[model samples]
Target: MMDAHRQNRLRALTTPVVLIAILLIFVLIVTATGDKSLARMAAQTLIRVIFVVGLWIFVGNSGVVSFGHAGFMAIGAYCSAWLTLRPQMKGMFLPDLPPWLASAEWPHLPATVVSGVLAALIALFVGAAILRLSGIAASIATFAFLAIVNTVYSNWEGVTGATSSVVGLDRYADEWVTLAWASVAVFVATLHANSASGLALRATREDEVAAAASGVNMYRHRLLSLVISGFFTGVSGVLLGHSLGVLNPNSFYLGITFITLAMLVVGGIGSLSGAVIGVLVLSVLIEGLVRFERGVDIGGASFALPSGAQEILIGIIMILVLIIRPSGLTGGRELRLPVLGWRVRHSKQEPQSTN
Candidate 1:
């Protein structure tokens, strides 16, 4: 009986282990590929992965859907852009800046850290306010926050260049840099998920009233998750700015926010591995479909999709995923290396005998 129980436990561990191995192999293969454009796409995908993972830390662990992560991203992007862009040109561009603001030159690393910290601070305030609400109200409040942020970013010319896209940022983000940051974000999120505070956060997510009855500080946990998520999302925004070499208020608008949310939902809201898978699958599908349309010829003539076809396709896929598997592809499964051809862990118990 004990042996049988042990076998079942081992069997339960198999799935995640195998998944981890496969994921590692996939990463290695992509990194080794000699295609520069593909490499660049992978790098961009990594940045998106970071953003989605950040969302997962809050939405997945806390069961609170947030549409305002883009606001945090915008904060990070603008902060990093302002810090790293040529200080000499600030007078030409941001003419109204204070004398001190017009003459600050910041290196890359410090600028990125500062950007992340600022975003975290913003999230601390926003989360404290919105986390007090429950259910749909919380979700709606988050969406409203997104709209408010967009409006401010669009019209705030003194700091954000108003509706115009901010330009001339130093391009320092690459695949390796993005990957390093992504790894860090993933590690931090995973650690948080397993810690005592993470358990309390998960309890609050599972049942807020019950958790509160048990003396868990629900609001505090939610706020902490939001702050942590904001910091990483900010880092992703910095990477995005550097990657694109420009910053635009419109880039972090509703469309991008929804897409990132979709990525998290389709990946699985309760698991980190799900977030990574969702981003990989969506990014590949969108990019590949667009490329296919660009390359295909129909009836002896070249064919190409309209500029926004990718968005439409992604939307369709999201709808299908929601209808078919709302919990996401991995559900709550983690990606980990397998032993003896098995993945995932299962609790062991003795089987009931009919005799």
Candidate 2:
């Protein structure tokens, strides 16, 4: 009986099973439909999986709300532009870039990596200062950091193209590439969740005073999670830039920030599977609403939703989910496949050590 229980724990404790299942489902749908528009939507959803999962790495474990990750996304997007754009295009569009950056052109692989690294470095440097705070104060500091980043990027004309879209980015992130990164995000997140740092952070999230008394360095764990989260968020930004063949500071602002958070919370911020499932469910709903707005054919007549109905409808859904399940759909539980008569559940009152 103990061995059977142990096997279930091993199976449910890791994130790869959930991710693989999700991937298989997504691929099956894409294959069956073979629709270009649907494929594009899938790519976008996968990208969101990366974003929400990365955000989960920090926010889920630390219990700290972050409005600053989008800034890291913007930084990553622009960093990709700096590394991957042709020299001539950089001269024309980003004249004020330092001399070396202006001439440097790298392939998508290296550029994507560098973009993530740069964002992680920035997170490391800034998080050392910011992670010292806790609760709402820490959340506010992150928001302030985000505001500062957005303000600077929006106004820096030559380096960031200011408020204008930076065109000529290479379109390299198709559905497959996005899937690869999303898988990486899931794997990394799961690994960290089972690691010492993730557990330490979650301990602090539950009771900071107790955790600190136990010799768990709250600040260090939070900073580490922030850096890891920043890296994956940065990668998502690079994928988005390549998908659109353009970079814009506004794209990484509040709109993306709020929606991602909504997804994370609705799916269960306490579980790794929550991040992936949230993106999948919410993205499908948004895309469906978009299609309805474009008009749907029913018995030879086209019915269309009003222009802004999608937002309103999605907002209602979010509210309903929050009201119905405050802890989210997964309720802090990992993926546990049922075996015969055995049932699996996470006790809500008891916080799991593997966050």
Cα-lDDT of candidate 1: 0.81
Question: What residue pairs clash in candidate 2, if any at all?
Answer: none
Clashes of each: 15, 0
TM-scores of all candidate predictions against the true structure: 0.86, 0.93
Which tens-of-lDDT digit does each residue in 89-203 have in candidate 1?
6655566666666677788899999999999999998988899997789999988888898898888787777887777887778777887788778878877787677889999
Model 2: runs farther than 4 Å from truth? 1-9, 339-355
Tens-digit lDDT string for candidate 2 (241-303): 998898888899999999999999999998888878888889999999999999999999999
* Candidate achieving the largest TM-score: 2
TM-score of 2: 0.93
User: After superposing candidate 1, which stretches have Cα over 4 Å from the reference?
Assistant: 1-32, 297-308, 340-355
